[model samples]
Target: MTTTQPIGVAVIGAGMAGRAHLAGYRAASTMYDAGLPGIRLVAVADIHEPFARDAARRYGYQRAETDWRAIAEAPDIDAVSVVVANPLHREIVEGLLAAGKHVLCEKPLAPTVADAEAMVRAAERSGRVAATGFTLRRSPAINAVRRQVTEGPLGRVQHFNGHYWCDYGHNSDAPMSWRYRGGPGSGALSDIGSHLVDVGEYFCGPVRGVRGAVLSIQVPDRPVPLGAAVGHSAAVEVSTERRRVGNEDIATFTATFASGAVGTFSVSRIARGLANALGFEVFSEGGAATFDMSRPAEFTLADSAPPADSDGYRRVVVGPQHAYIAAGLPMDFPGVGHGQNDFFAWQARAFLEQIAGLDRLPHCPTLADGLHNLRVLDAIVSSATADGKAVTVQ
Candidate 1:
């Protein structure tokens, strides 16, 4: 059997997304091998030593480092995944790119528009692969929608509606973290809403304007943590004292696309019983389609606008029609459910290819793409601060 040299890779941040990245890299070799380079799980880094070490052991990485700079400086590491928090992205990404290592940072790019812009500049200067964790772009069913929008059936996209709601912060005693950073470009709008912004651009086109937005602080205060906190819904000790939430809990906005199609998007961290409820619909003159991974392996489409009495959506099972589904499974048909990790593995393959200098695919969200979404998000906050007035996104 012919073999290729393993490309050394590292993952920073041992939190939730970090584990997903580990699994994706591990499975890439097994799931998709065409033009795939040999991969070596080299290291995992986190500020908290225990967390980093634990992830390394579980994921079979060769080393665990408390300082991310160690991974960046390590001569053997060819690429690194920056799964750190939003505020920390610029520093870690810039460092990795400067060290001549390709990097993949998780979404929202950074906490503020300025920070995202700086990261984009660094990526442009580095000339190495720089990608964001926009895993949904690889969704099999969603890709089916993209195919038709770009080629087959759907006429000019007229409107887009997206909702990414969650109940992780519904509890009044949730612990404080950098997620709730106040003023602007923070909270649910920047957290979950950024993904929706990307979705809008994917299905329709770039957002030309954010006409207005309403931001709400539903759960004003949360229990102050006595010590380090874990996941969003994990149990952690907290003091009786409360800290006012620095950002919003719920946000809704209206956007106009470059293609003249308008869109509406909303996100909430406090919506009860809606854990990861991400769903969207695109409407055009001829038809409409809806996709929600929350349902897993299913999407609805009305291929053409029927008579008013017969207008309805038809269930489309994820099958051979969607090209990427075959990569995740032995068969190229629908009804074979797609797990969240499947998307991650698909994303990993593209990232590895870029790092290997093989076939550079078209859809890995670059720092420039991330900056575009950040600009839209920044405009949302700007519009909200001005009391629901119109704001053109730069």
Candidate 2:
């Protein structure tokens, strides 16, 4: 006798992040079939038929729909992956929860704090598993760092610095995308700063308060696509048709965590020569720990107790012994090919395992995590608008 897979999965949205989720699910399914419990990719949904169709075919989904509601309400799909833009998060997530489907939503859960709170509440009341895509928390290196800090291997945590920098805005001609908009919780802070904020919380604990500064530069006026050209790659005369963006391309903030740890974070889309350069460092009484996405397979550990003659950071290569490391696929096998592949794969597996009743979901960075991140983001915007005056992160 053969046992069937336990759950049916649906992927919502067909953009960059949606594609990543599809790839992750597909990879997880492949891995599961090779000994792990498997999940079936049953359906996919997107506003764009082409994207939905193509992704469904590529990811081995059995069905595709242009309306997300169809996937959300489909009795066959047991879980939904929400990878749409920030503005659509609340509606989609609430709908999925109401439909009795488990949800895994991408980061920056909602466009506003109120909406994020509502989403959290809905998830809580629905009695369904809900998870936010704060991918950094799943990183092996970061996990190792978290272990060191928590276990006192790194002694008392003192200072933390996290930076997420990219060159997406350096091109003066880069067409206006939802990411550069204001109302959608777009801009540097929500797009990338969310990750930094999550990392800060993960390492040092909750943020009590924060102060920040924001700046908008580079292609202040972007050409808007005309009728029938929306979401298509096209360029026309630059027009300042939309209200000057109320969001910033760069933001830097400082915060005090619940553990009394002081931390600093900076996020930028205008930095030239950088592409998705996310890195963080934790300074403790005994030592310092660092991880740079640019150098994926290695983490650095400094000896705070180094002899007076020499004090420096030692590089630690993540190998087979690291957590989540299965036999053949050594920690360093993939290298930077997918900077956080192991972590992401592990997260996917965990989600699948939870659906299969094999494990309990982590209580961390849950819906509450999204709300806290949003509150911090709101505080950042308020502080920036107030000329860097400190704002309490409620």
lDDT of 2 by residue, 1-394 (tens): 1224667788898766786777777766544324445577888898878888888898788988999899877888887889887889999999999999888988888889999989999989998878888977767677777778888479768999889998877775656667767742368889889999888888888888987655454457565544312221344344555434556778887898878999988888888999779999999987899999898777899865677777788888765555454432333353423356555556676676666655443432578778888988888888777888889888
Tell me how far the alpha carbon of residue 132 in candidate 2 is from the true structure, in angstroms, after superposition. Answer: 0.7
TM-score, each model? Answer: 0.94, 0.89
- The C-alpha lDDT values of all candidates are 0.83, 0.76
- In model 2, state the lDDT of residue 4: 44
Highest-scoring model, lDDT: 1
TM-score of 1: 0.94
- Candidate whose TM-score is highest: 1
Output the worst ten-in-a-row residue range by lDDT, candidate 2. 227-236
lDDT of 1 by residue, 1-394 (tens): 1225578888999887888898788777766447666788999999988889899999899999999999989988887888877888899999999999888889989887788889999988988889998888888878788777888678778999999999988887778877776655588988888887888889888998886698899787887887665458447788888888888899998999889999998899999999888999988766788988687588888975467788789888887556566655655556767777788878887788777766645448899888888888888988999988888889
Colliding residue pairs in candidate 1: 318-334, 319-333, 319-334
Question: What's the TM for model 2?
Answer: 0.89
